[model samples]
Target: IGLSFVPDLKLANSLYALGSCYNTIALIYTKLSDHLRALEFHHNALAISKRIDNRRSVAQSYNNIANIYQDLEDYDSAMVYYERSLALKTEGNDRAGMASTLNNMGELMLATNRLNEAEKFFLESLEIKSESGNRAGEVYTQNNLARLALLKKDFPGAEQYLDITERTAQELGLLDELRVNYELRIALLKELNRPADAFRYSELLMVVKDSLMNREKAEALAGIQIAYEVSERDRQIAFLEKEGELRKSQLALRNTLIVVSLIILGLVYLQFRREHRNKEQIKTLLREMYHRFKNNLQLLSSVLSLSARELTDEQALQAVRSSESRVNAMALIHRKLFERKDEARSINLRDYITELITYLIHAYGYHERGIQTDLSLEPVQVDIDKAIPLGLIINELISNAFKHAFIDHQSPCLTVGSKLEEKATLNIEIRDNGVGMRPPAERRGESFGLKLVNMLMNELRGKYEVSTQSGTRYVLIIPL
Candidate 1:
C-alpha cells in the first residue's frame, strides 16, 4: 500500500507506516531467535522513521533496535541505543516517552548486574507514573521493580511493591496489570518459600490467561467480520491474482530476511572482534601499569628498610617496619596481576589473598623464631578493585598490632581471616596475641597508619568493632 500511494499525497504517512511495519516484523524475528534479521528490520524502521521526521517514532526505532541487541546480550550496543532514545525523548519533552525510556534503562542496568542503579531508575519512572495518574504504566513499573526486588532476595520489599500493583490493578479493573501481577505474585511467593501461596497465585494466573484468550477470540471474530465485508467485492473478483501476489511476496520476503540475517551476524562478528581487541588493549595497559607500580612500591620498601638500618632506635625501627608493610601490601597486588590469567575485572580472591598472606608472612618473617602469622582462608573471588583496597586495609591493621600491641613481648602471634556472612557480606577478623591497645587509642599518640586504616574501612562501607581483654581483636563486616 505504501509503495502504491502517490508520494506527494501520503509521503509522511507512508514513511510512518513503513517504519511501523518494519518494527513489528523485527519484533517477530527477534522472538523467533533470528537476531540478525531482527536487526536489519530495525535499521529499516529507523531509516523510514527518520525520513518521516517523527522524533518519537525514531526513538521507538532506537528502542526496538536496542531490544534486539539486548536479546543478543550485547550490553554495550544496547546502552548506546538506549542513550540515543533517551536523548530524543528529552529533546521532545515526551513525559510518557521519558517514563518508558527510564524503564528500559532500568532493565538494561539490571541486565548488566547493576541492581542499585536499576532500582533508582525504575522507582523514578514509577513516581512519574503515579503522579501523572498513569495507573497502568505505574503498575507495569511496579511489577518490574517487584521482580527486581525478588532477584535481590528482598522478598518483603517485593511483596510490598506487588501489593501496590495488585491494589491499583484490582481497583481500576486493569486486566494487563492483573496478568503481570498474578504471575509476579506467584514468583515472589515462591522466592519467600511459600510454595502453597505460590501455587494458589499460579492458579489465578491461569484463570486470568484463559479469560484473556476468550476476550481476544471474541474481539477477533468481530474484526474478521468487518474485514470480510470491506474486502468482499475485491476478494471475489481478484482472489487468484491476490493469492499469486501474496505467494510471490512471501518468497521475496523470505529471501530478504535470509540476507538480513547474514548481515546482522556479520555485524555482530565485527562488534565482538572489536570488543575483544579493546579488552586485550586494556589488559596490556593494566599489566604495564602494575609493572611500574611494583617498581615504585619496591623503591618505597627499600627506603623504609634503609631508614630502619640507619636508625638503631627501637621506635624509629617500628615506624620504618610499618611503612614497609604498607608498601609490601601494595606490591602484592602487582605481583598477583602478573601471575593471574589474562582478564580484566575478575580475580580469584582466595588465591590472591593466600598468595598475599604467604608473601607478607615471608617478607615480615612470620616463620622466624618468636614470630608466627596464622591465616585462615576460604574460597572467595571478589572483583580486584574491591579486593585491593580491602587487602591494603588488612595489611595496615595487622602491621600496627604486630608493632605496638606486642611491644617488648616474649613471643608474638597475629591472625587474619575472612568469612562469608549472611546476605553476601564479608566478615574479616584480625587479632593479635599481644598486649592490648593503649587505652583510648584515639586520644593517645596512636600511629597515623592506624588513622588511615580506619578511613579505608569507612570507604568500604564496612562496620568495624574492636575488643581487647588478653589481646586485641578487630571485626569488620563489609557487604559485597
Candidate 2:
C-alpha cells in the first residue's frame, strides 16, 4: 500500500510512510531474533528517514539499530548509536523518545559496572516518563533503580522501589515489567531472610516464565520454519559466491593476522616500558622527600643546641635540650625509612627502639655511669603517624629512668619490652630497678617531662599505668 501511494502522496509523506513500514517490519524481525534481517530493514528505514528529513523517524531508526547491537552484545556500537539517537531526540524535544533512549543508556551503564552513572540516567528517565504519563516506561525505570539499589546493598531502598514497580506493573497489566518485578522481589525477600516469601515469588516467576515461553513458542514456530527455509536458500547462494573468492579471503585473513600480531607486540612493549618508568619515578620521589624531611629535622636540632648553649638559666637550658632530643627521635624514623628498600609507610618497632636506646645511652653519658639496659622489643610494625608519638613517649620515659630513677642506686638497670596482646593491641613495659615514683605533691615541681609523656600518650590514643611496687614500671597499651 505504501509503495502504491508513493506517486499520489507528497514526496516527504511518501518517504516517511515507507520509512515507517520498514521500521515496523524491523521491529517484528527484532522480536523474532532475526538480527541480520532487522539490521538490514533498520538501515533501509534510516536512509529513507534521512532523505525525507524526518528527525523523529531518524531518531527512531537509530534507536532500533542500537537495540539490535545491544542484543548482539556489541556494546561499543550500541553506545554510539544510542548517543546519536539521544542527540536527535533532544533536538526534536521528544520527551517520550528521550526517556526510552535514556533507559537504554542506563541499562548499558549498569551492565558495564558504572553504577553511579546508571543511577543518574535511570532517575532522569523516570522523571521524564512520569511527566509524560508513560506508566510502562516509569515501571521499567523503577525496576532499574531497584536493581541499582540492590547492587549498593541498600535493601530498604530497593524494597521501596520494587514496591512501586510491582504496583505499577500490576495496575497496567504489563507482563514484561511484572516478570522483572517478580524476579527482583524474590531476590529482595531472600536478602531479607524471608524464605517463605521468597519461595512464593519464585513460584510466581516460574509461572510467568512458563506462560511467556508457551506464548512465544506458539507465535514463533511457523515464523521460524519460514525463516529457516529462506536462510538455507540464501546460505547456499552465499556458499557458491564465496567459493570463487576463497583464495582472496584467505590471503586477506593472513595479512590481517600479521598486522594484529605486530600491533599486540608493540602494545605489550609500550606497556612494559611505561610501568617501569612509573616505578622508577615513584622511588626517586619518595627518596628525595625523605631526604629533605630528615635534613630539616637535623637543622632544627642544630638550632635548638645553639640556643641551649646561649641560655644561662639551667631550667631553660634543660628545656631546649629536651626539645632537641624529641626532634632527633623523629629524625631517626625518617632516616630509617629512607635507608630501607621496602616502601611501606610503617617501620619495625623493634629496630627503631634498639637504635633509639643506643642514641639515648650515648647522649645521657650512661656508658660510664654503670647503667645496664635490657631491651626486649617484639617485631611489630607501626605506621609513621603513631610511630612518632610512640617514639617520643618512650624517649621521655627512658630518659627519666636514667636521669631520676637511678640517682641513688649504685647498680642501675633499665628494662624495656613490647608484646602483642589480644585484639591487635600492642603492650609495652618500661621498668627500672631504682627508687620508685615520688608522692604526687613532691613530683608536681619536677613533673614537666612526665606531663609531656602524658600528652604524647593522648596523641597515640593509648592508656598507660605506672606501678612503683619494687621499681618504676610503666605499662602502655595501644590499639593498632
Candidate 3:
C-alpha cells in the first residue's frame, strides 16, 4: 500500500508518510535478522526522506542502517552510520532518539570490552532518559550499567543496578526486558556462589524465554518468507529504475559542474598570483623602512658626536657621548634586521654584544688605555623589544667600568659572558678586574648610569645583582 501511494504522492507530507512506512518495514526486517532486505528498504526510505527534506526520518534511516551493520558485526561501518545518525538527531533536538543512540553506542563499547567508555555512555543515556520520563529507556540503561559493573568485578554495584532494572521491568510488565533481567540475575547469583538463587533465576529466565518465543512465533511465521521474497524482487526492480534516473540527472549536473569548476580554478589561480606579488612588495617595503631608519639613527649619532666636539664642559661632553652610544646600539639592531634574510624580529645576542663591545672600547679609547677585553658569549637570540634595553644596560655597565673601575690600575680587564640557565632563561655576567664598588652608605648618591640600568632591567622584566668582592661583577637574568 505504501509503494502504491509513492507513485500518486506529489506533496512532501505524503512522501514523508511513504518514507515512514518503508522505515517501519526496514525495522521489521532488521528485527527478523534479514539485514540485506532491511538495507534495501532503509535505502529507499532514506532516498524519499532526503527528497522531502524530512530530517527526523533521515536520522531514523541512518540509525536503522547502523543497527544492521552492528548486528552484522561490521563495527567500523556501524560507527560511521551511528555518528551520522547522532549528528542529525542532535541537530533536530530529538531527545528520545539521542538517548536510544547513546544506549546503542554503550552496547557497542561493552561488546568491545571498553567498560569505562561503555559506563560513560550508559550514564549519559540514563540521564537523558530519566529527564524525558522514559522509564523503559532507563531500565535498558540500568541493565547496561549492571553488565559493565559485572565485567569490572563490582558485584555489589552490579546487584544495585540489576535490582533497579528488574523492579522497573516487572512493574512495566516488559516481558522481553524481564527475561534479560532474570538472565543477569542468574549470572550475578552464580558469581556470588548462591547456586540455589542462580538456579531459581535460571528457571525464571527459561519461563520468560518460552513465553516470549510462543508469542512471537505465531506473528513471525505468518507468510513472512513469501512476503520477504516478493518485496526483495520489487525492491531490486525499483532500485534499478531509480539508478537509471539518477545517472541521467548526474550526467546533466556533471556538465554544469565542470564549467563552474574551471571558472573557479581560474579565479583561484589569479588570486594566488596577486597575493604572491603583494607579499613580495610588502617584504621589499619593510626592508626599505628598516634601511631608512638605520641611516637616520647613524645621522643622529654623527650630529651628537659633532656637538660633543664643540662642547666645553666635560659633563656635557660625557652626556653627548652617552647619547651617541645609545643611538648606535639602536642603529645596529635596525641594521641587523635589514641585513637578515629571514624575517625574524629577534637578533643574535652573541654577535650584537660582540660588535657593541668592540665599538664601545674604541669610543672610550679603552684599547689605547691598555684595557684587555675577553668575550665569552653563548649563541642566543633576543627579540628587538628586549634587546634594546639589554644593549643599553650592557653599555652603561661597560662604560662605567672602563671609566672609573680602571682609574688606579695599570692594566684593566673586562669580561662579558652569557649562558643559558635552566628554565629557558638567559644569564649574563660582566666582570672587571679593578677596584670594587663603594659601600652602600658611601654610594648613596643616585648614579645616572646605575639608575638607567635598573630602569632598563625593569622594562626587560628581569633582575640584576651587583657584587663588589675583589672586582665589580654584574649578573643579569632574563626569561626567553
Candidate 4:
C-alpha cells in the first residue's frame, strides 16, 4: 500500500511483482488461520498472474487457489484446480510439481467416497516422489497414505506408512512431521490392541507436540524482537525480502504465461499442420477402435447370419438373431458416446438414445416402427458407472420387445423416455404397443442378458418393474 503510488514503477513488472507479494501475504495469512484474508491476496495474485503470459505461474496460482478451497472443504473446486495444475505440470515437465498435484488430487479423492481410486493415485504419486528422491514429498504422501489406511481400518498398513514417515521426518529434522508421526503411531498401536505401547507413544507424542509448539512460538517471537534494534534497516530489508518474493512470483508467472500463450497462439498458426498430423493419428486410433467394435459385433452377427451360411437350424438362428439385436442395441449406445466425445466415462443419454433409436429403425427397416423419444430433460448426463450398465439394460428390454413382443408382420414401435425423478434418482421408461405379455412368468425370467441387467441394477441400487397394459412397459429408476 505504501508503494502503491510509486510513479516510476514499470506497469508490467510491477503488476507481476504485486501478484507475488499478494501470494506471500496470502501464505502468511493462511498460517495465521485468516483464510478469508489469504484468499483475498491469492485472488489479487491470480489477477496479475493471469495478466501475464506464464503457464507455470498460472498453474501455481491455480494451486494456491485450490489449497484455500481444500482448507474450506470445497473438495470439488480443489480437484478442478489440482487437475489444472497437473496439466500445466505435464506441459512443463515439472516432475516435482506433478507429484504435488497428484498428492493433492489423491487427497481430494479420499475426501470424496473414492477410497480405492484415492489409494491408487496416492501410490502412483509416492512412486513418482521416490523415483525423484523427493524425500520431503514422500514423507507427506506417506503421512496421507497412513491416514487413509487408518480410516480404512487397515491398522498394519497404517503402521507401515507411519514407521516410514517417522524415519524420513527424523532424517530431515522435521519436528512437526515427527510430532504428527508420533500421534499416528500411538493411534495405530491402540488400534492394533497394543495398549501399553499405545499409552507410551501417546505420552511421547504429547511431549513432542508441547516442545514443538513452544519452540515455534519462541523462535518467531525472538526473531521479531531481534529486529527491533535495527528496525529502520530491518524494515528496508523486510521490504526487499517481500519485494523479492513478490518479484520472483511475478517473473515466474509472467514467464510462464508468456511462454504458454506463445505456444498456444503458435499452435493456432500451425493449425493446419497440427491437424494434418493429428488427423492421421486420430484416424489410426478411431479406426482401430471401430475395427475392434466391428469385430465383436461381427462375431455376434456371424452366429445370427448362420441361415445365410446354411450352418445352423432355424431355432438356433432365431436365438442368435435375438442375441445379435441386443448386442447391436448396446453397440449403438457405445457408438453414440465414442463418436461424440470422450470414451472413458460419462455421456448424454438423451442424445445417445436418440442416435440409438435412429440406428435401430434403419436396421429393422420397419416402416410402421415410429420411434418417439420423450425426455423429461433437455439433455440427460450420467457417468458410465451408471450409464453404461443402464444403457445395456435399456437395450435388452427394447431388443426383447423388438424380437418377441412386436413379431411376425406386427406393427413394431417403441417409445423410450428418461428423466430425473430427483437430484439423485434417474427414471427411465420403455414402452411398446405391438404386443403385451399375457403373464409376467411367460418369459421364465432367465437369460444371460437379463441376468446381467438384473445384477447391474442390483449393484446400482435401482428398482426395475415390468408391466403389460396394452403393450409391454418396463420402468427403471436408478439413484446416482
TM-score of each: 0.46, 0.46, 0.47, 0.46
- Clashing residue pairs found in predicted model 3: none
Off by over 4 Å in 2: 1-273, 445-448
- Ten residues in sequence with the least summed lDDT for candidate 1: 1-10
What lDDT score goes with residue 38 in model 4? 87
Residue-by-residue lDDT tens digits, candidate 2, 98-206: 9999999999989888999999999889999999888888899999999999988898789889877875665555556768988988888788675634654565566
Kindly indicate the candidate among 2 and 4 with the higher lDDT: 2
Worst 10 residues of 4 by lDDT: 1-10
Across residues 1-480, which tens digit of lDDT does each residue of candidate 4 receive? 212312212444566656656776788789998988888878777777778877788888888889999999988888888888889988999888888888888888888868888898899899999999989789989998998898899876887798778756655555567677878787776776655346545654655565556555755665454334334443554576577754544444444344334435544644554334333433333334544554565576666555435645766665666666666655554455456543233578888777666655565555455544444433777764356567668767776666667766344567788887767788888888866876656666677767867877875679889888888888998987
Clash count list over all predictions: 0, 0, 0, 7
Better of 1 and 4 by lDDT: 1
Clashing pairs in 4: 53-257, 53-258, 54-256, 54-257, 54-258, 55-256, 55-257
Residue 61 lDDT, candidate 3, scale 0-100: 83
Candidate 2 residue pairs in clash (backbone atoms < 3 Å): none
Cα lDDT, all candidates: 0.71, 0.77, 0.77, 0.68
Question: What tens-digit string does per-residue lDDT give for candidate 3 at 123-201?
Answer: 9899999999999889988988988888899987988898778767755556667677888888887887756346545
